[model samples]
Target: MAFLPTSYEEMKQAGLDSVDFVYICGDAYVDHPSFGCAIITRTLEAFGYTCAILAQPDWNKDEEFLQFGEPRLGFLISAGNIDSMVNHYSVNRRRRDKDNYSDQGIMGKRPDRATIVYSQVVRRLFPHANILIGGIEASLRRLAHYDYWDDAVRRSILIDSQADLLMFGMGENTIIEVADALNSGMKIQDLVYIRGTAWKTKSLDSIFDDYIVLPSYEEVKTDKYAYAKSFMIQHENQDAIQSKMLIEPYDGWYVVVNQPPLPLSQEEMDFTYSLPYERTFHPKYTYIPAIEEVQFSITSNRGCFGNCAFCAITSHQGRIISTRSVESVVEEAKTITKMKNFKGYIHDIGGPSANFSRPACDKQREYGACAKRECLWPRKCPNMKVDHSHYVEMLDAVRELPGIKKVFIRSGIRYDYLMYDQDDTMFDRLVQYHVSGQLKVAPEHVSAEVLDKMGKPRKELYFKFVDKFYQKNKQFNKNQFLVPYLMSSHPGSTLKDAIELACYLKKIHHTPKQVQDFYPTPGTLATCMYYTEMDPRTKKPVYVAKTYHEKLEQRVLMQYSYPKNYALVKKALIKAGREDLIGNGPKCLIKTYPPRMVSKKKSSKKHIDK
Candidate 1:
């Protein structure tokens, strides 16, 4: 099918007087399945509903929001693929100059909180219209939690936006149920009890008896300990088979969070990705930077099991790993090879956690992921099924396709999981062909204490993985490097820990071009630690580098090679009481004096070192 209506003219061209749903988005419209707006709108279209796109509407103009008029079913809203605040600002709370998801890499097209902003405009223009909010922003912020940008705990987006309902997690099936219910003449408020959704009511009298009551907005707002305790409960009950209905008390009403929907099967995945996508950005736009890389890429799976404390995939997409069939993936590959700009390359292959193409174990379906345990954390579970043979076979199939030169896995494959698998063939193949110079992996920190707090394995695992990576490179006669994505100032990381990381990086003769300071956005466990200053799991006090000065000090140590960061590094070294690291010695992190520079004089000195 052609791209969904992006303009009023297109809606009329499609012979529709009014669309069933008009999707307001924070991103420029792209019809690829990787984008949530595309999938949700397309899913609605597949169900015989006419859907139109109001992509990145000017939040200040009510007229722009009313281009498609009021919808027959309801208006669906999403903060694009990423949260808007994260899209518009940096971890340091600085406004970003460019937006990769915007048209021609521009910023400021959307507001600070695009989901809530867009919803307000929709409500103003269409007073009686039904509004449904979804996507990562709404999903993660559905409960009252920490907001890093605001530097405070903010109530649920549902309360702030005043939307009719909030859809959490991947909402393909639940959305269909919602639409069908509304289509059957049910009011939005009465359309409760749907899984993977949250709605507000004045009282809990109508709520089913089996539900877990979280700390009230009033208590959690005033008490950090209460918020931490509440997060642990929300974290544990995410499983489909085991989750209890969650209800949180706000001012006058209660926000009822239903149990998460079960994961989509392989067949559902195939059907979803098989939808006729334009496979690129909307035609009206001349360019969209996000498409250039993913245009040729294919996602083979959905959901993640990595359970990184800093990542929200578990809370938003769940921990169950579900994959599309190899045949479906191969077909997508063939289709890409025939595209207008086919370049004989497929950029990436996996989802939330790449290399995870199946559930952690066979029993995951009947019995939910062990409520209290992880599949590959603390130590690899003996019952955990680990193999890369299916991925290897799929890669082989794609690479064997006609007109295919390289099938790179740009989306990161978890290094820990790769090491857990006993087989070495996939590793060898990856080093030999899939890598495009460097393979990326997130070993967030090197300190054992910090790694433990991040829910990641210690330095020993990263060292082992690095050793094996280089060994495979040597065996395959490939010179590909390992690019480790590192983080700074995660809850437990101290100036001492950051210095230790810098020393390790120096020993390895590597300096990263970029470093991520822990961003405490909504529902992640790491965010809980950042906000509460306590580990939610044990409710034990944990040290946190909360001050911007301290966080900058930690970040400076990571990139000490830069001349601009030299002063900060020296200050950090001095402040952390590691004066031993300030001399002109191999063990020293920085010199006592700046490098000499020649003074520009009209008289004599040509190149005097300063």
Candidate 2:
């Protein structure tokens, strides 16, 4: 199948004078099903709507937004698959030199806060064009959120972008309804009834008969407690079955986010994947680095139930798990084998969480995920269902397929879920065939208090999983290693907690090459905690490493085994009143001597006076 027209000349070459919708994306145009723009535009095209793309327009050049002229239905904007700020800057807020979404791994193709910038570009050039924003950037920032790059709370992106509508979350169903509504002559404001959409309006009196109102934007910005209170409401109401259309007042106007749509059914997932995707970036551009890893991989499912406080999966994809049938996955595997680049290996066959091939439990479909309780946090509920047999069966089928030498699951596996299952068949086979010498799993931190605040199960579960993993490897006569992903300075992580984790890593003889400092992005429970210094769930005080220096200290402490971090690690130990950890004992985290520090106590008269 031919790819969607990306230029005015191509649009005319396709015998269309005017396109219905012009989609603007910050990413290099890849026609793969995994990309959001591909799915939304293809779904629209399936319904017989004309569409074109304007990928990564130069924000400084307002004329760039005028490509494809003006669409009949208006403009669709996305900040690519990732938030632009996250893409442009590293966790330390340093400007990154390479962007995988750009051609040849170059940076600066998309402007900062790309959705808002692109929206502003469209609004400036074509004042009447309906601007609809979606994708991860708009999904998470649909409401007032903490901006880590700016270090302040900001209003909903709809307010800043002046976009007519925002489709939050996975937009397959939502975009279709939106297109139908707009196609049926419904005005932008009149499309309010569509679930999984948000809009800015001066009055909400006309919208809902029964709705939940969050604290005003001013209150959330000024009062951390108010922010926490409002976020708690947003989190509980995100489910499609039980969710309510929510409204938050923003000065004279309101930013109303409609209820999220239901997770795509198995049949629907299969159809979307079955679409005629060119399955690669447009041929005009060559050598895109982003598609390299996923070009041969398969996505078997969507949504994540793990709901780690730091993850965006819950906010964007929601907690429900839905999967394509095994036949569908196997069909895709056969297709992969036919590709010229086929190396007899499938890079990955997984989703947001690799092992989450089904809903958390049988009750999820009928009753919805429990609003008050998480399925697998604090403790796995007695009624919760745990099985990985189907997943194992799928892997076995793929492995047995002709011309398929090996299939690896690089997408992260939920170790906690693995430990909960009684049967070890899936675990055994995963070690035997899928692992590529190492398996990557996130433990985040080893401190119980830190993991508790992270919405992770107890540290004991991770330790148990590690032991079992090694045992399984031994049984299989394999030598796969576990690469634990650890994080630092999440809310409730104290210097003492960092020290505790350092000690634990030392005991395990596993010092991570790099430790990720907690990045307080929009729409995460941990971000709420990061901004407010309190858990939204309990509104209890949490010790967040707020200052940049404190964040650095915590990061360095996680890699305390490194020589470069010796000074910082020693300083942190002394500051935490655990100078005992700096001595030359087996338990000591750092060596006995300080590094070239002339004692300030002996250098200054003020120190003597004190």
Candidate 3:
């Protein structure tokens, strides 16, 4: 029930000679379910496995890794909640100045590619130890991936990390099975049969399931087309029910990934969140910046069905939605009310996609998500269930809880999904109760081609949603604002496309405060397109904004109202042959000249002397 032992003294104090797993992490230890390490470690403890927390340890030497001596079952490694490469660097591939996961928002707390670095160090120290790597870093990079940092295709993290086993996706059940098997005296090398795991083997002779072999490491590394094909195959097989075992070939070894594990049942989800989490950072640290946001928040669900191209939720959490029971969420809210600093507000009560509280359709429960189609992209599938009644009921219950003043859905709302639902009761309640003055939604791009490439709904759909939102606000007699999250420089976004998006914004008289530049991280359809300049599904050519200058221009166009971006906006407009926009017209993005320059041109010698 106490914090997991982070040192040998704590281990002795807990009367354990050795732990079943040494959970080495890149982030500072925070015992919250929001942190994957906490959930995994807590689940292990619930099942009677001892775990030692080795968080943000010195990777420059192996001595720090020796502190735990050796875990009895294995060394469980994770780069915390965020991928280490992403944690260390930004979308522009620059080293970040701050790390929220670190103590006191410090930087350089964890090494670059922390999972690989920590695993390699542990392997050197404990050559024969069982090394298991999971979390976002290992999960997304479990296969041949185009790493943006290296700008090259890299083999599975299972191979590079020298780990004995790699677990992907939500590992609650997978870890327990692996722990029980390891506890039952199964070797790490023999863990290939477990679902949601990928392992490196010298030979594929032991494989028994019907599996597909992906292109070799050499092939994907050298051939972009082959890489795109391989990525699409991987993307399609993400569902648990329909996915097959995937084998990726290397020179002397093959990495075989078993089909995804079945989605957690509602009871399992409730139990997972009900675990006795300290719900804060360890006592040793005064503050962990990551904890503040989630400390009072409740996660009511897991997984996402939206499955946007730029997001890795599908690859990491899978497409099927797994939700905690309403009673479970309400209980968590009650606990939050009892906290010493209990504010009346509950920060969030949603997961990856807030509106998704069940499977996309009943078919998903039986056959898994349609590999070739999406639930709410291009168009909502006819068979998909479009109801938010249960979600509204759940929220109603939470907001009614004693000591709870307001519950906000800050995670995100899929406006298209909301608009598709015939019943607007959820929308009504959201406007009346949950709007903390502003509701934020993602309308990533306005251009049809760019929207298609991002797997987002059409701009027309967003416009309809916008009108509906404002209409509802008017009906409620509330003056609420809709903050649309727009992204720039995504794959397939040419200069013209960006300009079109800017024009759409101009029509609304709204300038986005921030524009998310397309980040080509690993294991995403968009990232594949960014690397190959081709859509994996159709194999059609796609435009990618690769250069920093061009990407900046696109970003500037999104915020064209700012005077600092005038030069770049003008350049982009002229290059795209929108020179007519240079004049001082109502629809123009930028003027032909700055006020200072124009004033100087009109100034006379006499006016200057005066």
Candidate 4:
């Protein structure tokens, strides 16, 4: 009764045999070219290996795995982009805090659901095929990580999921190397020397002083009760540069090669640009829950130059932007109209910071604007550039495509770059053809200091753009809205800053209910700041908001619509000496006094409450 197929017979009927490798899992929405599946597929094809993607495959139904044809399944690569916790929880399990709750408060612990289901199906269908497991879930859980959110140590994913191997980090280079080694007749045991890969080996007790050493799976799995002791040892010695110990039951040690970032050559860049993409909506699979259905999605560019603290795009794709030609983009649009389910509308055309069509500063210039860091808190590099002309041309070409009724800019346009336009032609085109019932923009934070910390534009610029957008919309009699995506409780935000931001939101009448809390994803500059409070290189303490209450207050102020936030907001405002925003004040958004009533009730029932 599951939503997708699960058996190998069903996979065979679906024409999966034509592929040399079958990527049977992951939940990264199956689009967005830089995702793990796309990267692995492209890499394998580059090395003469045929690949097919089965994104978010339904493991419950046995028929799903059967659809991919004969078991020519040379390898089974699992990026495991979907978090096991998210899949099992109705609420956000990642939001739980240990200080405020017990271990029982942890709601989702079914980490083996997807892996178990996929493993069973794969074994039934292709018993001899190799299966791999990886992603954020596998990486952090590779060793028994202290899950602060769960308040307990969990076993490594290798023991729980029984995957043949677990690949981690930006997996493109690792996956390609793995596939090439296996295809070249290299045994799994022979790959211990490759960096960034983990496998089992023999001899757990002997240790040296060079690599990250982990307890053998046999020792940890000997008794579930002994897990806590082993976890404590690992945690206490996490920073120790111990010599690598060989994993028991095998001849060699499990190795993780910390691979250096690979620079993309011009030829590889050109080849990626030439890959065939329909870029059109197929009615059968155009069911995206986040956005409404439409035809055409042009990839104007790839990669991002801005290395924001909270983003992983730069690490995954690198800071250099790889753009497709304007002509090629238009041709892709033309092909969309030929599809039987074509809707005659281009839904989105962009990549990371879509407006950055060309480099912000010239790449060839030694002393150009691109050589200077724009913001330091989140840490912007000196080489990032912003060019808008290529984007403008891309929009123009798509607009001129045959049978295209309307073109929308659903992908985010970096406001900082867009604000640099000396001419209004880009804005003019946006008004003319871009679908505009609502336009999404990420201002992230409104505090000047927070903005600097996040490597974002000034709050003043966002307001200016908001005013211009409204003015232009009114002139054209269009009822479009600029939906801003804001973040709360980043490294530098304080309660005072949050209250100020709340007052600003009220002043502008910007009541965006949807906001995101900082998640501290790995490899982000912001995360580094949050953890160490020091610049990575300088090793000096920096200003950061570390208290939980301060973070909570800031989050509440970001969404002042909540009833309980009234007292906290009042306290924050008073503490900041901004009594001007009390009740029904000029810049106050909250209208109710329910929190005051609750405070009075608590005072009156103090004797009875105990």
**Candidate of highest lDDT:** 3
For all predictions, the C-alpha RMSD in Å is 4.0, 6.1, 5.0, 9.9
Tell me the spans in candidate 1 whose CA falls farther than 4 Å from its real position: 597-610
Summed over model 1, clashes come to 2
Score candidate 4 by lDDT: 0.55
Instruction: Report lDDT per candidate.
Output: 0.88, 0.87, 0.90, 0.55
Question: lDDT by residue for model 1 over 1-610, one digit each (tens)?
Answer: 7898998999999888998889999999999988999988888888888899999988887778878889998999998989999998889889999999999999888898889988888888888999999999999999998998888889999999989999999989988999999999999989887999999999887765599999999999889999998999999998877899999998788999999988998898898888888899988887999888788989988778778899998998888888888899999998899898997989988787769987898899788888899887887788889878778888999999999999999888788888987888878888988999878888888898899888888778878988999888889898778778889999999889999999887777677777888998888999999999999999999999998898989998988866678889988888889989888899887788865544553352221000
TM-score of 1: 0.96
lDDT of 4 by residue, 242-329 (tens): 2132232212435342332333343454455455433321223434331233235656665565557667555344444556777767
Give candidate 4's total backbone clashes. Answer: 35
Per residue, candidate 2 scores C-alpha lDDT tens digits across 35-117 of: 88899899999888989989887888866677678888879999998899999998889999999998898998988999998
Which lDDT value does model 1 have at 604?
29
Clashes (N, CA, C under 3 Å) per candidate: 2, 0, 0, 35
Measured on C-alpha atoms, candidate 2 has an lDDT of 0.87
lDDT of model 3, residue 57: 95
The ten-residue window of minimal lDDT in model 4 covers: 601-610
> 2 or 4: which has the higher TM-score?
2
TM-score of 2: 0.95
lDDT of 3 by residue, 1-610 (tens): 6999998888899998888899999999999999999999999999999999999999986777898898899999999898888888888889899999999999998989999999999999999999999999999999999999998899899999999999999999999999999999988877778999999888877777799999999999999999998998999999999999999999899999999888999999999999999999999997899977798899988889999999999999999999988899889988889989878899998999998999999989888999998888778899989888779989999999889999989999988888988998999999999988888889888888999999998888888888888888889998888877888999999999999988888777777666789888888899999999999989999989999998998999988877778888888888999998788899887777853433233332110000
